[model samples]
Target: MADRKEQDALIQQPDAEAEAEPEPEPEQLTGCGASALCDPRRKPHRFLVLMLMCSLSFGSYFCYDIPAALQTQIKQDMKVNSAQFMQLYAWYSWPNVILCFIGGFLIDRIFGIRLGTIIFSCFVVVGQVLFSFGALLNKYWLMEAARFVFGIGGESLAVAQNTYAVLWFKGRELNLVFGLQLSMARLGSTVNMNIMGPVYDAVERYIGVESYYCLGITFFIGGVTCLFSLACGLILGYLDKRAERILHRKSHGTEKVIKLSDVRYFPLSLWMIVMVCVFYYVAVFPFIGLGKVFFEEKFDFSPTHASAVNSIVYILSAPLSPFFGLIVDLVGKNLMWVLLAVSTTLGSHCLLAFTFWNPWIAMVIMGCSYSMLACSLWPLVAFVVEPHQLGTAYGCMQSIQNLGLAVVSLGSGAILDMSGYFMLELFFCACLCVALIFALLLYLINLFQGGKLNLSTRERRKLEDQSRS
Candidate 1:
């Protein structure tokens, strides 16, 4: 133990030394001055890129939760049990367990970010089309296959999306950018939660209540959103390419590339962060996937009201994330924020499991906690890993997160089938308990190693400048 602590102390010194080194200044603007409207270095142009990057995953986010939005309808129309219904989400996650890493690697090695983003967006479009057709034909097996395809593009696209954010926004407004991305993603989910039910009803009204037909039409409409995202991906690619040309920006391909063997050398804090990501999200996402039905069964809510309650988490997230990001940026005790998120989430689950108070209160608490966790947690990876390895590192995080979500989603369904909502909530509480412990371990390790993870932005900047001098 003593030797291990000494080794970590040795590692911390070099890590700080590496971070303290000064970086090259940006290349001079060529075609236009920095203040020009069309200059990529200008705030407006960067904001445009940010907006497009945020929208890149909006379609996938909207369609991914369609099954959950219309859970009761899907089960009844498709004639599948709870476990079978959850298989929609599970299949989406299963492929990502491996494919997301490959996708990230391709971004780093094979395809540059621009091409990678486009290809993954195309995959999302194709998968959504197939999924809609499967529903139209009432073929459950076909829908599952389509979900597998969608998962490949969906999760990988997220990796591409993160890389773009870091590439353009890092060290300046990364936390806010990540927050905005999460907000947009949650916005898509929230829109689907509230809109799908009404869309289904409208289709049913027009087509005289053919169950599978209405479902097919509803999902097909959702596919339009995916198409919109693909358009954004194309335009964003063009803009990024143009910016690179104008600025004489060099690609990371010219630098030391990420290798498979690099994973073994990742800091211990990175692994601990990954553990927190896996355990914390397994509780939140699986619950959301199954929450609508739980609200209906427990609170006796009508489908619309139940969906409204179920979607509160997303609704709150959309508005709260940017605000929380600003806080994390200013405060910068990321591990503390994570611990708070886990603790609040655990409390929220306990309230639902043990009490009969208004569920809105519990959901609201959970929602804010989720926003904090996301904005704080994800940006830590950029801080810990090298810029060249960001794609691979983000991909690894998503892959492991998907694995947890896939397993727990299926297990949550079975627990619902076998035990009931109370037991299921307890299971989630247990997961949060595990997450909280990991978070504390992370805090203690960082403290012993040098306390870099807990430093506020101002202090971090001061430390960097001092080290450089």
Candidate 2:
């Protein structure tokens, strides 16, 4: 009887053990069963995510490029000159410079992505409404006010998109993601060129050319686009929170807060690099904003033709930027990127200043120059700033860069107004000269700082040990 009872107990023990084992969670089961399961810390479906994010970014930046394409019609309707047309661009930049840091800080300290994105989207919608109303009524002040407000939203969106990229892609894929995002933004410029004319023509056919209804329709479309992006951002934020919860459960409360001040110890050479970015962008961005007009006035091209030519700059940039990023990753030195950018920019300006007789030649050179600078400058941001402070650092850098754009746009507008000719071409050459000088300064700073613009943790520790020795 005792042996029988013992056998039964032993048999029951195995069944109990089987019952006690917990079932795997749905995510774990699904992820394990499928080859496509994304390990959050590892490379997952990042390429796909990058594509989606880039598309969203492209949608947002469409607003930026629209004003430039619509400038001709706006000027005709508003009875504004080239200088006032230029101010429209400056209005877009100045508020971004003022609000970018605040936006960054808000992203970092207060609103974790989900709320920030939605709020910024609302700002974009409101701005678009104001702009549309202003255009419909031909109210210049209202248009300027709307543009300035839109700049804040645009800056916030820029930081948010960059933050999203950094969070999803780390180490090996970072530069590629940055390059791709930039390319997509350029694609927004392309889309503007492609759509603006067709949209305007359709509106004119329906409502007559004198109605100004086209601008309103365009703004409404932009607002709708922002709403779609906001919806996506909200979904992403929800998924991210769920992921964070899972990570927390797995780690058992081991996460720590990332300190912002840790990034301040970056080498002086990096600051010099930032300065170069500022000057380089200042030199180039205003020209980009005003490129169509400059080409129209100087080369006797129509607005559509001028826009087609200027679009080449961004089109060339879109394809070449990724290659430049790949090269930088392969070569493992940012200085090469810097040197190439400087050379191309200098050459382009020289061509523009000296070879005005051949507009096609000038266009090609300008396109190449713009491509080089864009590819080189954007990726360098990751190397210069700490990962945690990336949003803030990028914001500050953008603020400074936008300041340059604003000043150049305003000053050049004044110059054109005073001189009764497009001095933007000459101004572009002078700005490039400043950029070249700063690029040289950056190289010198790197040389002085032991030929290392950035140091790894191990290298920094080694230097500290040597200092102690």
Candidate 3:
């Protein structure tokens, strides 16, 4: 121990000397036109700008899910059946899945986040106006069209948020920021579930009739919120411009080319990870869409009571995500956590499948399963992908996941109609089983391959040492 301490002291000696060395001449330091006395301790104003951007992005993206939560109310008001109501959810997801990759490319190459945010905000605004009209006039086709267009906008914003977070927050509390952003969005979903019911009730009472007035108001508010988000984007663009100028002057205007080949494996691993994400969401999100109605019908509860119970999942999920992220960062082994989370999720589904139970008890168990999966699974993408490719990888994953959700939503609706019961729960349980099998296969592959993917040599050494000890 003494020798090891001496060796550590010796290793740090050179760095101490370097700090003690004489300062360079003023001309040598000042040639780049940057201040030598810039205080690293002072916080950058850019962080504040980025936070606002993230908040706005969260608000806009969440509007996509809000409509789905209010589906039954919308259907009853519009006099449409469950099949037609389900199509609205499909419209919201389908365009996003189809155009997600393209959104990523545009964000990385042509538009960057500034133009992308603005362009996408327009789509959201236009879609909201059309949706508001449909709600007021009881035009189902128009509502579906609005949902499709809104999805394009929301998908672009989703990609932009992930990309922007990677660019602006890398190596500086990135895990915390990612978790916080996600939690905020889930908070939006929580709010939608809990508050929308009361709001809809009030709106229906106020409109002098029982109608889909709340849906119209919700879309209108979303449109206005999007405009606010666009303004935040403009501010972020300005700050980015200022930061770029400072960096250029400091680096003597030399352009740095980051080689994409160095990160090729990142994208490859991300593709497999996205497949995992798709299966996970396929097993989960449709249940979220149908949760309230299913619980109400299965257990004979009021709509408000059902929604409140379902809201527990989102509420519990929001706060737990950050802790899960901290665990991943601290442990530095994502695969084990992924396996554990998926295993627990599978068990939860199996329990739900095999038994008939009270709605509250079932929701609690489902919420726990979803919380584990939601928090643990997403951070794995950051582990597998390069920092530069985060946007593309996240976008690709979102696209695939959205596709699965879209298909499952439509199929589950048809199945529910045909089977004469809410069969989505069983179908989703089967999907979870498949996901568990895939997770096991991925684990075995990593085990045989010496845990090379995502794990650095140092990390592997630590794991091996821990095992031996």
Candidate 4:
């Protein structure tokens, strides 16, 4: 025991030396990011900013799912097929493949987050407006084009959102905060899914369901959600700017100017992060895009019932994620949680594909897995990279994720056209298996090369300081 103590002391000696050296301190805001350096009794209005961040994408989330919920009606009314309906997601994701990364670069290098948020929010508004009008006019290509525009904004806005999360809550309960944000977003999706059909039925009662105008008007009502998000984005921008000026968030000599060269410097862990994100999402979201139809066909559900059943994933996620995030924060095994989440998700897909279980049970299980993964997954990125690079890293990841969404989304729809929904589920299983492999690989990598990622923010930062020295 004495020898063990000596060995421990020897191990901590270098850490002691590193602590003596000055390092770039992590962000610390007293009184909730206001200038309350003297008063440390309470947190600042950071939670208020968190609320803004949560609502920042509410509109996008609301509108994004409407198409999915209204998929059957759209195909029937427009005489479109599954593949053509899926093209909406493809159009939204394809432009973001490059643009999201560029927007992130601009945020890191030139535009800064405030400008990026507003610019992206504007694109969201205009694209949604265009989409609404295109639907009204029954111009399918126009709707696709508008979705493309919305994609551009959506991806960048996501990067901005991640940037804000790290900026305010980096060393705090970041996982909890991210989970809460996702909960808010998922709530929007859930609400959109549930409301769209009922609202459409009501609107059709008044306006008559014969024309594309009704579809367009129904979508336009959802598009208004984005306008509300845009307002919150503006408010967030003003508040962020004020905080930056007042809080002096960025430390001198710690400012990093992002360049094309730095892109090459991202570590292997980051690539794995990208890989996992791409594969996991290609499995998850594209499935959601087509889920309503799947439930209707395979489960023998009515259209309204099918939409509600499919939305069960989002519905449960809205309330469950914050607790899952808190669990992640407390347990400090984010990677393990992520792995389990994916594994369970894979199980849910399998149950749907193979078993005769009630689809609602499978969906609720999937929903819990979704929330669990949501809390554990994104917060891992903040650990892998520095604050300055968070935007670029998230951007790059979003871009890659978009690529997956675009290609797999189209392919999934095409497979549904050629093979059927069961085959599509198999494909999702395949993608998620790949994601699971990446997660396992990440755990092994971190285990062998210093397991900083699973540590709390304070512990991780301290270890980072020691390693830098």
Candidate 5:
């Protein structure tokens, strides 16, 4: 009876279709499962939603790099040594080390992503404003206080961004989503590096070349960018509220709150992910923070060219990240990709530390690997824990990552101050080598687990249930 009814309906559908254009052939489903699973309504909104995620953090990222770009200038203006300069970075990261975890906990339990984003965005704006004003005054302690305040918002806002991506893109093209977010982030940093020197030069014509007001105005522009981000956050919150109301989606907060004891349930793979994050960033960020100076000293590049050289990693990342992500989404074997990323990074640092080859080549290779490893790694947390714990999972990862950044950055600054760039290179190289080891361990863990973690989207669906975890 069902067959006969289907045949009759097929015949009847011809008359209906004849009046309309022919339907296009359906595209093959390439993600983890059939389109039957995800909401067709949500598809069109995903990219817009992702844009919101990306832009809401843009100012924070842009502002984050300004001090590094003006590292030498700041030292001269404040009459601070490298060790004192390191305090700026330390203050920015250390408080956030504890705050991000609590922020993540709040996102998971109390405030939802929307409200959390707004509040954190506010923190970024206030902190940037304080930092800018402090720069104008040339008060070192005031600047340090401003950094501490900005740190309150900066990383927690990042955690919110990651949580937003997971909430919307979970289990479906999440690697690509993460890659895009990262691209935007790197683009922000890239733009800051490329433009700030010129911006300083341009402003110097009006403010005088050595005036503290130049840095003040530059950072004030950054604060305006944060205002733009805050506006976007408000819009995003409204749109999300509308979506939830119309879709009757489960409000994530109403679900089970994350108990502190949930840490016991995290898989070994998750811990491996955290370790890799800590080690890898310790090498990359500290280097970039010091890169312009490194190039000026080692390669005799001009300040402008040195900033360009230093920014090569971010320059490559802006375009290549999504490409790497697409490859990972299609190819899977995420752990292998991570291993490749870590290995390349270690090689790049070694090239910088030991040889005289063009640093640009090393940076390009490291940039590609940076995107690959990052996209591959973050998504693994989604795989390791249940959906509800994702905020804490990301929080936990960022917390540890912040700690590594704080300690390594502080130490590397001191090394550069006392020992010279060679010692700093050695420190960064050692960190990368440790990161490489963790990547290898991840591969081994996958091997021992029947390689389920490595299977392609099409393959994973064949054997396992397609829940978020």
Candidate 6:
């Protein structure tokens, strides 16, 4: 009887142990799944996400440059001088000084990337509509207010865009990804510069030339682009959510709350980069903002010709940025690329300011260099900062950049009005020289810090492997 009881106990123990053992998790998909196109980790899906992310900012970029695109009509119809015309850009930059930083924080803290993108996109649509209405009613104040609101969305959306780029592409294809994004953004701007003038002219036939209503109608067309961007935002959110669920991605954000104190720990090299952003971009953007008129007045070009020339920078950037980005990725030496970009840009400005060459030559050179700078410069932030702190870091850089843009937009307008385009170009050259100086400082700092920022993709990967080993 004792032997029989022991046998039963042993059988029961085996049954209990089997029940307690956990089942194996189902095999997770890491590569092209059954449907490769639908697999989030696959290249096709990543390309889709990249396209959506890049298109996400298309509307804002298009609308933001509307004033530049139709500068002649906006100023003439609205009865504003060069200074007040620049107020359009100044108002756009003003609120972004603080709001963009908050936007980045919110992306990190409260709202994740998907939700943040949608909300900012909505702001763009609403602001554009209000801007159109203001033009219809011929209220300059309302137009400025609309631009202020538009800016709030526009710049924040950019921060979110940058965050998304780093989130998915961080090590793989990061440079080309950024380059593609710049390409799409410049495409939007180029489309605006080329089409807005024709759009205004077409609208003018019905509403009459120099009518604010005509400007209003032309701007309303831009709202359609915003709507398209908003839709992309929605689809991207859904895809991102689906990917997160399937892939169990834990890199979105950390469980630990981000603190302002984190800023203190950021390296000094990042601050120098920030200053470089401020100085370099202040020269470029403000010039583009007021470029149409400068081209018309200086080069003796017709309105159509001036618009074409003014858009050349964006035209070159649209197709070339991605290529330049690929080169930067393969070659590395991002600081050297940055230095080359600034020097070339300075030379271009000198040509425009001092020489009487075909404006196209100078514009083409500026365009290519601008593309190189964008691909090389923006990615530096991702290198110096941790993933979790990317939002804050990018936000700070853009905020300070907006501040510089705001001050300089106003200053450039004043200089243009009082001094002339030649002087305005000189002002730009000076800003670039200062930027070059800072770029040099950054090179020295990076050199002493082991030159990680300047390493090619292969070298970086090898170094990372060595560290891990």
Top of the candidates by lDDT = 1
Per-candidate TM equals: 0.92, 0.83, 0.81, 0.89, 0.88, 0.92
User: Which residue pairs come into collision in candidate 5?
Assistant: none
Tell how far residue 249 is off in model 6, in angstroms: 1.4
lDDT of 5 at 193: 86
Clash pairs (backbone) in predicted model 6: none
Off by over 4 Å in 1: 1-36, 251-254
Clashing pairs in 2: none
Q: Which ten contiguous residues of candidate 3 have the minimum total lDDT?
A: 1-10
| Model 3 / residue 451 / CA error / Å | 4.8
TM-score winner between candidates 2 and 6: 6
Predict model 6's lDDT versus the native: 0.86
After superposition, which runs of candidate 2 have C-alpha atoms over 4 Å from their true positions? 1-44, 246-267, 420-422, 451-469
Error of 5 at 136 (Å): 0.8
Please report, as a residue range, the 10-residue window in candidate 4 with the lowest summed lDDT. 1-10
Q: How many clashes would you count in candidate 4?
A: 3
Superposition TM-score, candidate 4 onto the true structure: 0.89
TM-score, prediction 6: 0.92
> Which residue runs does candidate 3 get wrong by more than 4 Å?
1-50, 247-268, 386-388, 420-422, 450-469
* CA lDDT of every candidate: 0.86, 0.65, 0.64, 0.82, 0.79, 0.86
Error of 1 at 71 (Å): 0.4
Q: Candidate 3 has what TM-score? A: 0.81
Per-residue alpha-carbon lDDT of candidate 5 for residues 189-230, written as tens digits (9 for 90 to 100): 898888877777788787675567788887787678789889
Sum up the clashes in candidate 6.
0
List model 4 lDDT by residue over 197-286, tens digit each.
888788889987675778888888888899899999998887766554443333222233557678898888888878988988898888
For model 2, the local distance difference test gives 0.65
* Candidates, ranked, lDDT: 1, 6, 4, 5, 2, 3
lDDT: worst 10-residue window of model 5 = 3-12
Between candidates 4 and 5, the one scoring higher on lDDT is 4
Q: Candidate 6's error at 194, in angstroms? A: 0.4
Summarize candidate 3's per-residue lDDT along 388-410 as a digit string, tens digits: 45556677778887898788888
